[model samples]
Target: MPNPKITTLIITYNEMDYIQKCIDSIDFTDEIIVVDSYSTDGTYEYLLHHPKVKVIQNPFENFTSQKSFALKQAKNDWVLFLDADEVVPEKLKLEIKSTIENTDCAAFWFYRKFMFQNKPLNYSGWQTDKNYRLFRKSKAKFSDKKIVHETLVVDGKSGILNEKLIHYCYKNYEDYKSKMLKYGRLKAKEDFYKENYFNYLVYILKPAWKFFNHYILRLGILDGKKGLIICYLNALGVLERYKELKRLEKKNELAYHLVMP
Candidate 1:
């Protein structure tokens, strides 16, 4: 007749600025498990001293492996995978507490209200942005197939929370651009592993379509300047992805020729 205990899990690297607030927001959780990727910016030390936090310093690997490792460290059956840059609002905190107390599904999806430069982004293909943050550890897991944008596999039914998670996704344009470029490179590597091929035509179409789809079809125009910047950078990220993909193909070709007689 007692409510199930919950563990708030977060994998972080150089997230000192946001870590404190993130933890402060979720202090209601029964336990907080943080799997740090050997952060050098004093983030590791900060978490080490936090009484509520149990920090594990693991070598920097792909997102999938890191998250999967964090998932296993949960002491309770209910696990919430939270990003360091995200904060659980009071309403969301209350919602989560009540949900787990009466949850019927194996997992719960939380829609994120993304923030850019402290402004909430209402569109730009973000209206439907959701992640399976709250879930039963035994019923959900991070799949190791795609390393960068890792997929969460849920064995049973799922539910969606009414309150949106407040996600401070990007501090500024430069910050967002740098992260997206890195993501693009990682995505290219994933595609390379799968032997996915794309020609010159893809380079032109993908980025163009990305911009058009998000800005136009997704009603990003309503968000004005913020939406424009996001859509443009998103397309740039696609271009970066394909550019890296092309470079990878050429590198492989060169290696094959060198090895051949």
Candidate 2:
């Protein structure tokens, strides 16, 4: 058979729960490259047994660095980046295949359909989410931001795929809180170094606005309990960011004075 035109790339870190489904969805690709962050879980073992997959073990660093490493390791000219908790729907798989074979666009953004507790969340401000996952390897690279929510920067023309990629973002409340705390800390560090500050008005207004925007304006209410939960958690994430930022600022100031004095 002729060589496959696309390479599927994924990065994993203790993603045992979703790794199997993620791998199964992209079996159509010519090549699959998984760069794992030394998962203590059985993720590495599972990938090793998969015949179509090539696994690379690297130490955990930042999202962009890990994804860029995977991008470089891809053998095919076209690359599709998928998270371990995300799967390409069968319809999306066919759409992507057709796009790759027929179109000359360098990149295509896939609409993501997020699920919470196995429920399809039609609102919660998540319906508008789109990601540039399918791209020509030569035309794009991930930004070297030291954060978990980094994005790919593509150099050529890009288009959108109508089909949705299923994204299982959070399984439960505890999982949500755990990620929020970790992400809040990283965001706080970035803001503190950039001399960003939060005032009383912003501290109160930001979270409120976030809830209003996601739940009310974005029609998240239609999604029922899942929408409310997501909106509440999103606001909490914003609040935690401000709290962590202030804490980091105070710590940095104390360290600076002690070292100079």
Candidate 3:
């Protein structure tokens, strides 16, 4: 039987460090469609010469929208969505090729193994990570509500894949902090726009709960220093997000009063 053709879709921003490796990992695929956000870090320039890769620039508004646009650009029935910081290992590649040729379901979910600070983490909420990234083009659509965490809604039956998708999540504290700040602000804006009420008590208690949940309840302590840092930083991110949300609310309120009352 002939190998089934698949279009790999990727949404990227300033991802120069991981873009090349991410594209190279799926070299066996038929076509790669990348929707970049006018990367100032030379990510777009580096991918310009690749023959099999088609790249386009769109101002990134949110994850769901950017991904939806990329999905439309896909030229094949079977499509795979990958992040610039992720790679499909050889084993997973073989499985993907074989599965696509004989897929019984419309979509497949694969477990993701995350690498943080150059170390692969086995616990602390990373072990349970899974996402539906491979699907029939017509069967998948990202949820309409764009937020910090957007999920894909599959129209038909979904199956699980045996192999794991390797994710290079963060190389160090600086990488983690950059994403933390960016995502924090985005999430705060989403929450504010959604009219989610903010409670002072909840704000004070939430981060503490998050730290405990990750560090102790989730066995983050077992992973050593990296785990502790990860858990703590995540907690900090939650706190910072709420703080940003509060700031936005205050600024809007002041503007309204100054203009009218």
Candidate 4:
């Protein structure tokens, strides 16, 4: 078999439960490069022991920089950038191998099957969720300084893969809330850096709008309880984003006052 070697790159932080499963699914790759953010949950040690994995311990600054760094570390031009919480399906593996050889595209987008707390949400604004995960290292690059959804830029042509990647996104209630709050804070920092602060009115209206947009407009009602939970949590994440944004605003104000003598 003429193998077009692929370097699978992953950026992780404390993803102990899912990391091993994520790696085990991608056994077809040429080499696995795991960029871990000093995980204390035994994830780093496990990857270090794995024979096929080339584990690198790097401080996670943000998603964009970490992913960009991972891209540069790829030995092969064909790179499959995957999250530690996501698993490549069996069919996707075969599809990827075939497409990399047959297709002339610079990069490819893969749609995901979103799972939340052991349940699948068919709607809740997740119907068409997709990302450019498979791409040529030389052709694709990530947008700078985005804390979440660090957009990937493809230079040439792009296409979508047939099979969907399974994303075990939210494990439980507490876990989901913690993640949303953390993402909201990170996004707030990015916004603060870019001088994109919002007003006091946004604190209430934005969160309300997010819930309605997801649950009502996006047809989240169809997914039942799972959909309701997902939609509520997603809206909560948005609320946290604006709350953290205000926190940052107050923080800088205090610092400015203290420094002025």
Candidate 5:
């Protein structure tokens, strides 16, 4: 049988627990490129021993820069980007192998099955979460956004894949909160730099509205306690982002006055 003509690219930062499983699932790929962020954990050591993996140590920049760097490193014309915390299911792996062999589409989006604390989230505004993961190397690249969430800038046609990729988001509230704080700070800094000021209404009302939309309108309440937790966290994330933006603006204003005066 002929080997699948695609490369798998994964960007990592201390993702030791999930890296091996993610790698094992994509055994069909012709090449595997792992661009790491100088992980102090055993992730680097394990990748070094893996015969199939090409490991490159790049210091932490942002998502877009790191992913764009990884895209350039891929040997195959076709590429699949996988997060270290996400696992490609067996059926999805087979589907990817077959789809790439047959289809001419430049990219394929797959449904991500989100799991929170070992339970699959059937509701809670997470279902039908599709992301473009498979694409032609030359046709797409990561946007130059220095932030937590970076979108793919694709020039070619894109389609959807049938199967799903499992995403293990957060084990508990603490994990969610930690990410919220970090991402909020980064997002706030980005907004502040762009001169996007935070309004009183936006800061307060937006979070409340988001909670209502996610938990009530989206039927997140049907999922029980987990749903409520997800909604609360989502709202908290919004609030933190606004608060961080205000703090950043204040700091910048103080620095400017000090330097000028």
Candidate 6:
């Protein structure tokens, strides 16, 4: 088989802190396309001046819509999606190039190592991170109905790569808090719309289960302080989602679902 060319796609909002490094890491790609959500943090300005980067400005929506827009802008048949906070290391880049050249699979998965302040966390349920980031553009697309965690839809065979993709998750507590709150609210709203609302018992047990599953069952304790922090935060996020769902249901203010698309 002939070596295939690939395009790198990224979606961003206020990701200036990680955007430059993320883009620099994927310099081997045939083309890099960034679809920004009119970021006010100068992220758009930086990409605008980069000679090798192509920038497109779009309004902020959910993750699925933003990524779907980026997918359409890709110029090559093989496309790799990278989060603004993710960096493709040299070893992974070489593996990716080699995979596209020899594999006929529709998509390839990469293990991700989540980083906290430049250190990797080998526990906290993060060690199991695997994402399908590389795929043939014609055979794959992101699901349209998701709000928080979006999934890719690949029409054919899939395979996995041995290298790890580095994810610079959050810079600090403030960053983590801000993102989790947003995610919690979005997930709650999605649950409300789907009529998956739960009662008090569920609200209480769900968070507990999340903590136990991630911290104890997943061996998050082995990772020490940072792992504990991650596990607790994960539980708190779950509680917040259920609380938000109940709050909206009590006031009968679920009209927001009508406006969401």
Top of the candidates by lDDT: 1
Q: For every model in order, what is the number of clashing pairs?
A: 0, 0, 0, 0, 0, 0
Candidate 2 residue lDDT tens string, 7-111: 999999888988998999999898999999888889999998899999999886667778888888988899999999999889998898877877778899989
Model 3, backbone clash pairs (residues 3+ apart or across chains), number: 0
Q: What TM-score does structure 5 among the candidates reach?
A: 0.93
> With candidate 2 superimposed using the best TM-score fit, by how many Å does residue 121's alpha carbon deviate from the native?
0.5
RMSD of each: 1.3, 1.9, 1.5, 1.4, 1.8, 3.3
Winner on TM-score (1 vs 3): 1
- Per-candidate TM equals 0.95, 0.92, 0.95, 0.95, 0.93, 0.93
| Better candidate number, 2 or 3, judged by TM-score | 3
For model 1, residues 1-261, the per-residue Cα lDDT tens digits are 898999999999888878998999998899999999989899999999999999999886688988988888898999988999999999999899888887679999999999987898899998999998999999988887898878989999999999999999877888789978988888888988899996889989999999999999998898899999999998999999999999999999999999999
Model 2, TM vs. native: 0.92
lDDT of 5 at 205: 96
lDDT of 2: 0.86
Model 3 residue 222 CA deviation (Å) reads 1.1
Candidate 3 lDDT (Cα, whole model)?
A: 0.87
* TM-score of candidate 4 on Cα atoms, chains taken together: 0.95
Q: Lowest lDDT 10-mer window, candidate 2?
A: 143-152
lDDT of each: 0.91, 0.86, 0.87, 0.89, 0.86, 0.89
Over 4 Å off, model 5: 1-4
Q: Which stretches of candidate 2 lie over 4 Å from their true place?
A: 1-4
